[model samples]
Target: MAETQKEILVRYLQSAREALLWKLDGLGEYDVRRPITPTGTNLLGLVKHVASVELGYFVSCFGRELPVPLPWLEDDAEINADMWATPDESREDIVGLYHLSWEASGRTFDELELESEGEVPWWRPGQRTVTLQQLLVHMIAETNRHAGHADIVRETIDGAAGLRAGVSNLPDEGFDWPSYVDRVESAARTFRASDG
Candidate 1:
């Protein structure tokens, strides 16, 4: 049996969404909100950013309104405000908002055909127009890119790395943890020496 185009797109989109959310497991509020990178990328912030993107592309772009207020996403908010969780914003709040966002986006997906057209107000006027198919593909790519970022952020915090929990997402190497670290370090040193 052949899966429909919408089914395929939805599968990929859901995979990315779950992967992003899973990165928050087994962590405290500090870990979820800690600024792992210089740019202030955190687990909660990633979820918030994805939620905002979903609202803009899936709901707002289709002549609909976002169901909730996102101050960081508003026009007058500070730049990059979506990239970090605020002091007053708890982990639960951001996660709940993301879940609600998923519900709103899912409705949009169900109600619109692939050929349905919409506009992205934030984009350059000429290029703002998009179809449901285009937004689906664009968002899949965007979410997957951020999932990669989440993967690295998780690894940095606690050495957790994989596509998902149950799968053997990496090559089955016989090397122990210490040797793996040494092998990687040696490769970096070798490359540095070659560059000298």
Candidate 2:
């Protein structure tokens, strides 16, 4: 059976969401909240940022009001709340809010046709209008890029490497773990010696 354009977009968006969520798997509050970079890229913060962006594009951009008022907004202030999570924000709360945002966004996406246009009031006048399809593509790409960062951050936290939960399905089951580490260390030393 041929899938509709909406189906494909939804699938991709869902995949990216799953990948992002997967990064939080088997991780504790300390790990999820720990800043991995100078910019404070934490798992919970990433989830919160995505939720804010998705709500803006899929809901607010389409003239659909958000259920809750955005906390970062202030009088005559252009605070970009989507950049990071606040200290008081708990891991569960952010993740739950993100899931809710996904549902709200998904509902909007499902109801709108690919050609249905909406004006982003925040954008330049002529460039404000966009189709649901465009937003879907943009969100998918944006989410995946963050997911890549999540993958690296998660791996660095605990040596857990893979696209999703569990060990990656590698065919090299016969390889010894200790020997693999030794070989990698040997290669590093050899490279350093060559440089010196």
Q: Estimate each model's TM-score.
A: 0.92, 0.82
Evaluate model 1: give its lDDT. Answer: 0.90
Candidate 2 runs further than 4 Å off:
73-81, 166-196
Weakest 10 consecutive residues, lDDT, candidate 2?
73-82
lDDT of 1 by residue, 141-174 (tens): 9999999999999999998888887864986756
Model 1 ranges off by over 4 Å: 171-174, 193-196
TM-score of 1: 0.92
The local distance difference test score of each candidate is 0.90, 0.82
Candidate 2: residue 136 lDDT (0-100): 89
lDDT of 2 by residue, 5-121 (tens): 899998999988988988898898888888898877878778887887788889998989896666764345455465566678777778888888888997897789988898777
Whole-structure CA lDDT of model 2: 0.82
Number of the predicted model whose TM-score against the real structure is largest: 1
